[model samples]
Target: MKAILLIGHGSRAKEAKDVFIKVSNGLQERVKSKVYIAFMENATPSIEDAFVSIREDGVRYVDVLPYFLFEGIHIKEDIPEILREMKEKYDVEIEFKRPIEYHELIIDILIDRLKGAGICI
Candidate 1:
């Protein structure tokens, strides 16, 4: 089976973890694959750790999706660097996916989130 490693920029707040946990759980059910949530900083389960765990779970193919808003330095440099390290370490092949911000649905979701949070559009 395949695996998806949802990598987010980490935050100290439990509420922040809640957001990623919910997304990871949804993905786990929807994709029917092992889903792991990881962070680039300030948290456990770094991208490397997630890749290792997924590989150990018998997932030969892994796709890493950066849970970021844009192609900033973290997306361009840090994430790629981390993926490269993961690729080198893992015996199986791995693929890296683009950020979710490119998807049209994200805008719709963000608008809905704004509404849910009682923010005026």
Candidate 2:
């Protein structure tokens, strides 16, 4: 089976965790493939744990999607490094997708947030 792993830069704040959970749930509903959420730090279900879950679910390939806005250190270096290690250890093949900022929909979402906050842009 194929799976999607949504990687987020975990936050200490409860609200941040809530948001990730909600988004992951939403994606799980919309996509045909299985979707799993994992954090880089400051949260539960680390990447390794997520990989284990994916493997347990009989996932043979995964498309890792970083739930980030930009190509920051986590996107460019940290995630890839972890993925490299996971690929070596697991029986599954994995690849990383570009951050959300690479998508045109992000502009629409940003504009919606700005408008909701009464910030005309």
Best by TM-score: 2
* lDDT, candidate 1, at 26: 82
- Write down the TM-score of every candidate: 0.84, 0.90
lDDT of 2: 0.92
lDDT of 2 by residue, 10-73 (tens): 9999999999999999999999998999999999889999999998888989999999889999
Candidate 2: segments with Cα more than 4 A from true spot: 119-121
Cα lDDT tens digits, model 1, 1-121, are 7777889999888898888889888878888767788999987778878877887788877778888888889988988887777777886566778776677887898899999999999
Local distance difference test, candidate 1: 0.82
Clashing pairs in model 1?
A: none
Please, what is the whole-model Cα lDDT of each candidate in the order they appear? 0.82, 0.92
Worst 10 residues of 1 by lDDT: 92-101
